[model samples]
Target: MTTVSEAILSRRSIRSFLDKPVPPDLISKIITQAARAPSGGNLQPWYVDIVTEDSHKRLLDLIQTKIASNPTGETKHYDFYPSDLPDKYTNRRRATGAGLYEAMGIAYDDKEARWDAMKLNWAFFGAPVGLFFSIDKFMGKNQWCHLGMLMQNISLLAIENGLATCMQEAWAVYSDTMHEFLNLPEERIFYCGMALGYEDKNAPVNKFITKRENITEFVSFID
Candidate 1:
């Protein structure tokens, strides 16, 4: 019986997962609960595509092939981050990456090792369940924000159900390929992917805890 606050505090971007399969019924229940997340005008702009077992294998193979043929990756349908990240944002990003690499004993200069570790993302970090999120191409930035709320809800609900998740914008680089493989309509644009399952608690990468700014840093109160 995890409280919402506890779930929020405990949830992490789990990069490694155990081999255990998540029951479809459980996934259904999670989604049903997460759907309660609010959207402006109740547009409910997010659409999810679930991959598991054999279908997951097929999607992984297709992604691997694409990666091998075009190691640089494809153009994303939407930008996940700012093109010119300011110093404040870039500094935080570097710190998080450095921490993760240190946890895994990957040296800062080891580019090859880093690339190898990143390749595991295509495999969903061995999670038994993978989810792809998409939205209609016509949706604007407000709808995109709505999608984020839905995703956060799913992540928190997952923690309540003894599951862990990693939201991967890296999947956006393969948007075109995924669109074709999933047979989604041309008007639907891939937003992001999520890995879901029980975390590999013993993995070194799983132990990395990223830092967050103090509440005062971003909050403002006017009398």
Candidate 2:
């Protein structure tokens, strides 16, 4: 059995997935385990919906038209990053993006290639399963944090089971489309999407793992 530490170290935002299908039963099992994640007041905030098989195809077909007409996508329902993000955060984001493109052998000046790569987010990077996460619109940041804990649990559990996942905030752009397709009520606000499946071992985009800051960078000792 894989240890918690192994799952933590091995997990990455997998951008490439194999064509293999993940059984619906396995997906349900991982979600059941993630339900154990701690939540404030046990509100659990997160509402998860998944797409696989024929449903997945239907979603892609619906979105493809929107993609062709407005490749830039709709206005994001929530901010993925602050409008005036600090240099520290900006630097880290840039570093990660650079490493990602480098792994894909995409040149920095190649605008078309970069956009092509970015578009992959809409297709969930070819992952066989896509998970949509949402929370009540009235919830505060605390509840949002709780939702994140749930997602983290899902990520870790997925790794332990030989599945990889990529948390795609890009899905926020088509919030209305997704809400309509999923037949979800307006009270629930779409937050993010996660691509889940077996990794494509030979894909270049999955070749590099992003870096993490040392504990000293953000942690402090009370002593």
Candidate 3:
């Protein structure tokens, strides 16, 4: 049996994907299992939009138009990350970004290339399925945190089945476009998106790994 430890240790954010479709049954099973994730008061407060048709093409079209108008356009609904981030969080974000760019041979000073690279998010990073997460507007940050737990659950379940995934905040950049395209009700807001499929194990970007803080830095135990 695969222990929980084995599953946790092996899960990773897979960015490069092969161009193969994930069967509906498999995708259904994955979501069904991940829904087992615990939520406070069982409000669940989450909804997912699965993209598999011309709908994805329409979404890409809308996003492209927005990006053309403002390459660093304001995210349509909520800001994905803090604008004035603290040192610890900022460093972690920069290091991984640098690592990813370096892997793709993008120069440190290349703004256009970096933004070009970011455009891949709308393409689902070449994955066959794109899943967008949404949450009710009234839910507090605690509920959003619960939604994250649910997302992680989905990613881990994918890993256990030899599939791969990348959870993306980039999708929120086009939330208004998405909301219109998906015809989602006004009460829900974009929380995030995810690309799910088999990894292109040979891709150099898949090899990038950012350092994480040690337990001593972020953990406390009073025993």
Per-prediction TM-score to the true structure, in the order listed: 0.98, 0.97, 0.93
lDDT of 2 by residue, 47-95 (tens): 9999999999999898888889988778778888889989999999999
Top TM-score prediction, candidate number: 1
| Cα lDDT, all candidates | 0.92, 0.92, 0.84
User: After superposing candidate 1, which stretches have Cα over 4 Å from the reference?
Assistant: none
The true-structure Cα RMSD of candidate 2 reads: 0.9
lDDT of 3 by residue, 1-223 (tens): 5567877877777778998888889989989998888899998877988987576677777788888887765656875678999998988888888989999889868998988888998788888889999988989999998888889888988888878899888877767777877788898887778999999999988888767688999899999
Give all candidate RMSDs, comma-separated: 0.8, 0.9, 1.6
Model 1 agreement with the true structure over 1-223: per-residue lDDT tens digits: 9998999999889999999999999999999889888899999899999999999989998999999999888876777788999999999999998998898899988999999888888889989999989999999989989889889999999999999999999888888898988899988988889999999999999999898899999999988
Model 1: how far residue 221 lies from native, Å:
0.6
Candidate 3 stretches with Cα past 4 Å from truth are 74-76
Cα deviation of 165, candidate 3, in Å: 0.7
Off by over 4 Å in 2: none
Q: Candidate 2, overall lDDT? A: 0.92
